[model samples]
Target: MSNTPRTLFDKVWDAHVVRQIEDGPSILFIDRHFIHEVTSPVAFLGLQQRGIGVMFPDRTFATADHNTPTINQHLPVQDPFSANQLKALETNSSKYGISHWGLGNPKNGIVHVVGPENGITLPGMTIVCGDSHTSTHGAFGAIAFGIGTSEVEMVLASQCIMQPKAKKMRIAVDGKIGKGVTPKDVILYIIAKISASGATGYFVEYAGSVFENMSMEGRMTVCNMSIEMGARGGMIAPDETTFNYINGREKAPKGADWDKALAYWKTLKTDEGASFDVELKYDAADIEPMITYGTNPGMGMGISNKIPVAEALGGGQASFEKSLQYMGFQKEDSLIGKKVDYVFIGSCTNGRIEDFRAFASIVKGRKKADNVTAWIVPGSHIVEQQIKEEGILDILTEAGFQLRQPGCSACLAMNDDKIPAGKYAVSTSNRNFEGRQGPGSRTLLASPLVAAAAAVTGVVTDPRDLM
Candidate 1:
């Protein structure tokens, strides 16, 4: 080992380098590779065409989510393309001896959600998936990021990826967060301050009291959106909280293995004198429940704040005005009291058990507004079970909301749960880009509490008011 102090990212990345080519990308060994219906099908086809098999089928896991219908999962898929992808995923996983979790399986769910709950994600591991939110696994102190289809195939064949290392960035938040603020709100506040491309070509490590005190689920929510700010991925140093969340979970180390794993995990932290390429800090008190008014995640502000005029925002004034026009809003317009046509509370980002509890807290005694269409989908079968076990389903039912099966629904327009054209939706999912939810659909990305508030009130409202 070198005498120089190293960051958490350095410790993990250095350990995984298989070969460093002169003046080119290093070949880094991958610890875990997760694939889904949409991204894995093509990679598998490429594998067959090349007459090569997976190098480590045990390290790769497959699940059906991106293209599966959130409702009527038991029935045959209506879309021919989606059905073919799902079938291909099952067939390929079986042929290659990889673990497969298809719809109707108790373990089936979104690829990201199922990975952590089942203990497939662990500290100090290098994980990758075809989906951008693969960064979610980094909450465990792992080096995780999204890869392209060709790279996915490369990993399946060789268990290695060629990549130039990303620059390291550290974002720290201190002070106490106010009521109604959530992990989602904190990240939105960060992205808005830095702009969407601020962290381009960097890997972020979250530090300070705020992230240290956040729950594993909350930490996952924050890391999951790191890509929205142009980060390669985001991670937090593992601690007792991370250990506790993994203990006793299926596929996690146990007995002598548990002790050995825990000892190694304790070392997955930044050294005292380590430095990053860039560093930034924020006060938690400055963040509140946030919502995106324009087409991007960075185009956001506190729920109670008015949209800033174009000149004050600085940058592309024409693009800013165009974003507002796309959303049917004007400069200086307030987000509060804006009518919402739909509310969705599930995705790899905020579709955890804690998110549902937050939603239920706001809708406990209230009923859904007659004009607001609500889609309360869980992230996985495990999360769905948790909702029913914790009585969150009952609260949603009493509020005139129906729970949908687990899947990556409405976060994108890939499945049947798309937002209608010209409709306004308060969503807990990450991203609010133009037509992200559906063609011509207007999206306001907010926390689960904000979505619940809109579900009941039929308009944008501050979640703190209800709390």
Candidate 2:
């Protein structure tokens, strides 16, 4: 091995390069390729059109998510397009000899959630999916990112992808985060500090005490939203927390294989003297439970803060005004006490057990506000089962909230779960882009605690106050 120091991103990416084309993109071998109903059909159809089979079917995993209804999943799908896509995914996966978890399968859930829970996602791997949140897997110290339909077809055909390497950035946060703050808050704060496009053209490595001490689920939450800030992806160096989370999972290595894997994983960290193209740091004490006041994730501020005036914005004035108008708000407005029509507590970003626990903590004793329509969703069936086992379901039921089955419910408008037009929702999902949850539906991205607080109070209340 070379004696030069390397960052974790460099180490993992360098190990995966199949060939570095001179002055062009590198061809990198992919360790995991996750596909869903929305983006895989065209890629598979392309393969059929070309009369080619999947190069390494074992490396690709398929699950019906984007189009599957969260409720009554066992019943036939109602939408023709969604049904067709679901059918196509199953048929294609079967024909390609790829492992598939379709609706009603006990193992089924969002592609990102199922991968890590089943040990299919590992440290130092190169992972890709057609969805942007594929960065969620980067929580394992892997080099993971989203790909387009064409790139998906390419990977399916060769188990390799061609891509230019992204610049490296290290974002380190030191000190203990305040109470009621979460990994979601930390990421939102980071995105607000650096605008939505701040980390564009870079793959980030989160370091320092904050990420190191975060749970694997928390790390996944942080990494899941990396793309929202315009990053190629974001990773956290694997450590004992990662190992323990992966150990004994359904497909994790066992016995001697576990020993070997653990040994390798332990080495998946940045060397002391490694350098990054850009570096930034934050103090954890400054972060608070956060919420997005405008359309984009970067429009976030502390829960207690007011929306900035147009003059204060300095740039993007027109876009900022448009975002606020879309959300039915004005500059200098305080989001606190604003009426919320809906609340969502699940997605690949914050649908883990811990997020549910946080939501439950805030709602355990409080009843749901009569004006709020709340959707409690789990990331996967496994997480749904976890909610039931941990009594979260009971707490939710008592609080007048219903637990929807998994499969990316309310994160997007693809499935039956959608926020009505002209309504405001406080969501735990990653993005708050206009109509992201549904057409003309204003979304306020926040942590589960914040969502829960809003759910119970029917307003954008501070989770800290509830806590």
Candidate 3:
């Protein structure tokens, strides 16, 4: 309706529009561009071919994450391909004069984690990276999304990318969440309810009491998984929670600038009468600690529930059968008591300090299952430091679990922390696609609490049961 006010997405998108073409995409200015080793090499090569320097080097930040080894990062990278990619990133950042946080640097960590922790991600900004998880920055009310190598080049050359605006959707989860449930569980439940492609062509805004009660770290975990459900991105409107989280961060504004920024951020919410192209609502009490049974994130269920029979799946039965076949599962089989070979509790999705604390809470006095190989990684050096200061590392060690260095370890098989072939892992990462954790490795995505339950019992045990 013409009388309806603009939503958060409209305000941010309209503010960043550099130019609107008559019949084509708008040229949108990017406020922050994050580059990681894995995706920036080709884009930098393109820049070299064009002989064009980066338009705004100050707007871009580079880091080595996907290809960085979690262990012995002080030593030289062992894999030749990985070593070259890291080297390329260093070279490109140096030549382009962009700020880079390489291995051994105090700020070095996953780009998504490091950006927000260091205040590089601010409210009302347009952020992009070559990685899909860039949507994580949207927790601060920013318009952040993933871009391809070509789009990377476009941003580097002109600080702008041509893009069509996404339709708006609002997903509201209300009521009090039950015990043992985490933000990871909330997002997983949503994806399972709507299917993987449910939010396609839309930018989603999360609202209601559930998100309002969540900490900044918890909110990041939910927004980080937006890409898994086929949404362009997801965000939460800025409020006191957002302001408090950003106030004293390293890159956040200071003094008068802080006051000015806060005033503007307060106005970034959807108006009372704002209309959305689509809307979804859920009751928080209905969600439980969740886990995936098949190869996709949407193929998930509450930990206490049985997998749906083929007739219950909306997709083609053949495809559903193939997913089950790959996961070594039969229709309607319960996941409880199923043996697990590994348990990984880190990733952009659930690698924050809160995630570590949750895992430590579960494994404090219990020893890990002898058959389970548990990899507990922090998202950043700051988180790693916090774990030590909070004594979480000591509790983990006493429980027979090792705390690995900061990096995107085991989330993907890119680094040294890969699950062996044919092994099943209970992972807290976003994706569980075929071979996502390693060649022939089967991934059952779950919350950190669920992963902790698997680590201690060596099976797909319900977290609530352990509680």
Candidate 4:
């Protein structure tokens, strides 16, 4: 082996490799496996067909998110199909003795959100889920990413997966971020700069002052979008911030165990002089409140800037034109005064308590625009409780907004929260792909602050203007 220093990704990856196949993928061990309703059913079926028991049930966690309705969750799931999926998850979890936080469980919420809150996510571990936003766990310095149904089954049966190593990348953002900028803006800006495929074939580690100073929630928001940039996953080195976030979590280690874990966690950082296959840096000040104007996350611009002229787009003119057409926009159109029909302020990307606080902050003294329908869904039941306990719900209610129950509402068109056809929505979700929120629906991905601004103004207004 070479005597080179190792990046955080390198160190974590190396420690998790069970065995190296000759000229092939390594047998990588998974320390934690998270499952959700949308993808776990097939994997669990495969296990039943193979008559295999889960190798280590304690290491696996299951939750129902994607298909669960945001409201009326207290009653039976109204949609039969969604109910079936949730039932399947519960059945499989029970059959396999895996810990499950089903709908209405106090612990139930988005898998990504629940994992960190419960401390199921930890530093120096390998974490995987069937959802692409599994990168959210990487914010705690774990090597986390999404997997396919087959890979999920493999992990369930064997606690390991065959994986080729990914190249390492470092994205460093320095300097002070300006007021009104949130972590969602930081990621949207990065995707816009690098394009959606910029980090293909790599695992990125976010460094520099901006990420270092970011809150755990903020770091999670940034890492949650790593897949949009085509990176396998993204991570940040564990620090005091990470420890503090994990310290008192429900599932976090206790007493002596905590001390032992803390010592190891402290060591989970990139070594000095380590090299990456690729490196990119940006000034945090250069990033502002951002919004996507096209069908892709990379098609974003600062709230103060006009949309790009078609001639300036990277993809072929035909596709670029098609995307703009889908969004009912023309090249060089300014989004500033564009009418917005809906505002969504919840997702795994921005559905935490922090996100709600940001939304409430913007709309505290303002009324929701009558023309704009706003859906404020939290990511989990815990977050919902926190919203009420913190009086954020009261602020939202006084602002003419209702707090919806927790679920992955409107982030995708999977359930009852879909946007109507041909309507425009400013969403805080990770994706802005055509029809992602609903058929014929147009989504503009943005931060919770930006979405809040749109909710109160009925237009794409700069959050800074409201501030």
List runs of model 4 lying over 4 Å from the truth.
1-3
Q: How close is candidate 4 to the true structure, as a TM-score?
A: 0.99
Give one digit per residue, the lDDT tens place, for model 4 in 1-467.
Answer: 44778899999999999999999999999999999998999998898899888999999999999999888888998889988999999999999899989988999999999999999999999999998999999999999999999999999999999999999999999999998999999999999999899898999999999999999999999999999999999999999999999988989999999999999988888888999999999999899999999998889999888888766756778888899999999887889989999999999999999999999899999999999999999999999999999999899999899988888889996998989989999999999898999999999999999999999999999999989
| Displacement of the residue 426 alpha carbon in candidate 3, Å | 0.3
The models' CA-based lDDT, in order, is 0.95, 0.93, 0.92, 0.93
Worst lDDT run of 10 residues, candidate 3, spans 1-10
Q: Could you give me the TM-score of model 3 versus the true structure? A: 0.99
Q: Write the per-residue lDDT of candidate 3 for residues 1-467, one digit (tens) a residue.
A: 43669899988999999899988899999999999998889998998898889999999999888978888889999999999999998999998899999999989988899999999999999999999999999999999999999999999999999999899999999999999999999999999988889888999999999999999999999999998899999999988888888889998999999999988999999888888999999999899889999988999999889999867776879888999998899988999999999999988998889999999888878999999999888999999999999999999999999888888988887988989888999999999999999988999999999999999999999888778
Give candidates' CA RMSD values in order: 0.7, 0.8, 1.1, 1.0
Across 136-227, the per-residue lDDT of candidate 2 in tens digits comes to 99999999999999999999999999999999999999999999999999999999999899999999999999998999999999999999
C-alpha TM-score for every candidate = 0.99, 0.99, 0.99, 0.99
| CA deviation > 4 Å runs, candidate 2 | none
Error of 3 at 140 (Å): 0.6
lDDT of 1 at 218: 99
- Per-residue lDDT tens digits for candidate 1, residues 317-394, read 989988999999988999999999999999999999999999999999999999999999999999999999999999
What lDDT would candidate 4 get against the real structure?
Answer: 0.93
> Candidate 3: where are CA atoms >4 Å away?
1-4
lDDT-superior candidate, 1 or 3: 1
TM-score between model 2 and native: 0.99
